[model samples]
Target: MTIATLPAYPPKPRPGDRVAVVSPSAGLPEVFPRPYELGLERLRRDFGVEVVEYPTTRKMAAPEERARDLNAAFGDPSVKAVISSIGGDDQITVLPYLDRELIRAHPKPFFGMSDNTNLLAYLWSTGIVGYHGGAVMTEFGRPGAMHPLTEASLRAALFTHGEHELRPADTYRDVDRDWADPAAFAGEPPMEPGSGWTWRNADRVAEGVSWGGNVEILSWLLMADREIAPDPSVYDGCVLFLETSEDMPSALDVFGILRAMGERGLLQRFSALLWGRPKAWSLESPNSAQEKVRYANDQRAAVLRAVEAYVPSIPVVLDVDFGHTDPQLVIPYGGRIRVDGPAGRVTVTY
Candidate 1:
């Protein structure tokens, strides 16, 4: 999708604009109100934007309800933007019930990540550029305080229009703290110093529209054939950005999914890739410090193997902060991405 053909990025909302916060996926807000409330508080105090919640924002409701909230939020002139309370696994279910024509007529900036990727991809296909970052419970309500990088990225996406250069976090944390414990909100999570971005085939530059989201989520979309363009050439000059979730699918599993895309002649369509830092630790798969390091290293290798198999010459940047990791960047769905290997810079047009 070229800039001309890609959806027009919806207008950025003003500081006093009312923004809708809905749960288009699982209602973790139902169980974990601490983070959700803190997130909403920040939306008002920090962002100076009024927050609006729907029936399903903090409740486990039907997909139909979630879609209706989205319609109402976008259809209302007072509501300038909409964001998710958090992402969930069943956002794909809500997609079927969404009215594309209604949404197409009332395009508003939508911010989210993880399984909200379903909605981002859906919005992209329907001719709207969605923000692939800023889930309320996660990024905004990060314990202690939000990361400066995350705040800057979110603000630029919400308030400005221009090309922004993406940078690797000086430090990052992939581990999670139990939200159920009030103590968890008392301090920031541990952070490890970053080694910076790893680049391959870094002799040239590639510029195109950015595509792809959570790697595992993309596998789901591929299987469902929901919003992915059928023609290979549709992504001919795209920059594919992908990341994994806290589930931390095995290195082999990672390769298998990318390999499937490779076999379908999909892997080679992009001129470059922005591979996000893999989330290596979760409550269920808690690993030793050494194991976490090894997990990230192994997944990086798996990603390289798949890319090497089909697109060895394309520039690939690894460890970009755009997925489940802390201090994440807001990537523009169906927006321009410039990967300049020689300059060692990745600039995104928002």
Candidate 2:
């Protein structure tokens, strides 16, 4: 199998740039108006970026229409960047309708996570690096103000280049404050203290191109054979970043996916694995602190089991901040990533 070589097209946006905000998935703006408004406001005030919207950006429209908006955003030269309001589950359906030539022609900075993973992978296929964080509603439109860590990471991702070191947030929040309640915007939420990252089987530092996204999403990509390279060697020595979503998939399910990747000759090709902090609890299943800790630990163990079984030599870093957790850090898909196991540090070159 031959690995797919990604094209290189840089899309850098400065403050005061015109950025388009689109909803490629569910239009939560229709349901939750407050956060949607707050998100738009912050994009203007905080980032000093003009927020543009398309017809389907805030509508529950057909998949083809959503694809059209995405293509239009990339096709327009004045649009310096494109961001998603939030992720939805059905973005996979929008894949076929997207115009690859249009996206490739413009190649602007695109930011999203979760279901937007579909678009990120698509952008990768077009050779443009896409950011995997900072949705308008979720990150920018947090009930309170945006998390400081989130803001800092977003700044680095949007404005800077070269290698940027990633630091775990000193504290974190996972509980969702009501968007409709105006009082929720009064202040930041209470946060629990957190320890730094946990390293596994550290030996040598490794640096390579980064890949992987929400693990469940990646499974869907694999099943669909979307943009993922068939040749495992294309991922040779690359860093693998994986995270779970709010759906709170079981540890067994997590392991099963990695096991399948191992079977596909993918697990052995990477030099390091960066696991995102697992979102153990959601509105649907609110686990206790102890339960959440146990769930995260169990999931980490499951990932370790798969690594040991398939690629024991690969360095593993657990609980780096990304995915559904609060104050999530943005990761550059298809960009360069460095993992220094000896120093217990990781950095990405955007």
Candidate 3:
């Protein structure tokens, strides 16, 4: 069978656009009120966009109801885009209940990551371009204020058009301060010095339609066969972007998943890979400064080993800022991605 070409869904958001914010996953706002409120305020005041919330936007309801809210948002013609309030673990369950025809008929930009990967993949399958970053509560709803990098990236993704070069942020943060404590906004989280992109096996530049998401989430997609095609040719010349979740899967787990992709002939097809910064630690698995550094290094090595074994020529960029970490950058699924392996530059056509 011939593999289908990746669909290109044009960018939709603009300043003064009315975007619908829904909780297709866990309703974190009902639990964590501060960041949720801040996220809403930023959407209105900072971006100059109107924020519309659905009935189940903050309700911890069943997957069917969440899917209903998604359909309602997309069905409304006035809504320019849809943004997730936050991500949850079981968004996979909501897949079966989604109205694919409705979503396809009204393709609008959807922004999210983590568990929202489920929705992103669903939208992609329906020929919609979904962004893979900037959840309402996390990035826009940042406690002290939005990171400069995050704000800049979101602006381009929302209002601007054409080729947007993605530069690595000079510094990054993952830890969250207390949203309830107003004093927590007194200072920004400490950021360590970061280097430019590290390219592996950089021999030539390659450009392709981009795909892939949180590695752990993609594994779930693989298991369910939700959106990912079984044939490797579907991913041929595609730029793959992947990052680990807060679970911080061990190096072995990361290797095993890639090994599975290799076995499926998926690894060898990608033109290039953008590996997101592995969230070294989270609140549950808080590690020392030294340990976090080690963890990130180990994860990188594991990915390199898998690529070397399966797709040695594909250039791999380490520590891209898109995944379970703070100051996340949005990636357009089924969109144009340029990887200049020699110059060590990456640009996305939104």
lDDT of each: 0.90, 0.86, 0.85
User: Candidate 2: worst 10 consecutive residues by lDDT?
Assistant: 1-10
Give the better candidate number (1 or 2) by lDDT: 1
RMSD of each: 1.7, 1.6, 1.7
**Best model number under lDDT:** 1
TM-score preference between candidates 1 and 2, better one: 1
Give lDDT tens digits, candidate 2, residues 1-350.
12346546376889989999999988888878778898999999999999999998777888999999998898889999999998989998999999987887788888999999888878877788889999999999986688888898888888778777889889877766777678877887778887678888777898887888999988998998887776667778888999999899999999999999999999888989999988888888899999998999899999999998999988888888888998799999878889998888899876
What ranges in model 2 sit over 4 Å off? 1-4, 7-9
Superposed by TM-score, candidate 3 places the C-alpha of residue 179 at a distance from the truth, in angstroms, of 4.4
- TM value for model 3: 0.96
Determine which window of 10 residues in candidate 3 has minimal summed lDDT: 1-10
Give the winner by lDDT: 1 or 3. 1
Pairs that collide in candidate 2 are 7-127
Best by TM-score: 1
Ranking by lDDT: 1, 2, 3
- Where model 1 places Cα greater than 4 Å from the true spot, the runs are 1-4
For residues 105-220, what per-residue lDDT tens digits would candidate 3 score against the true structure? 88888899889989888877677778888899888887668988889888888776678888887887766566667776576677767656688867789899888898888888
Q: Tell me the lDDT of candidate 1.
A: 0.90
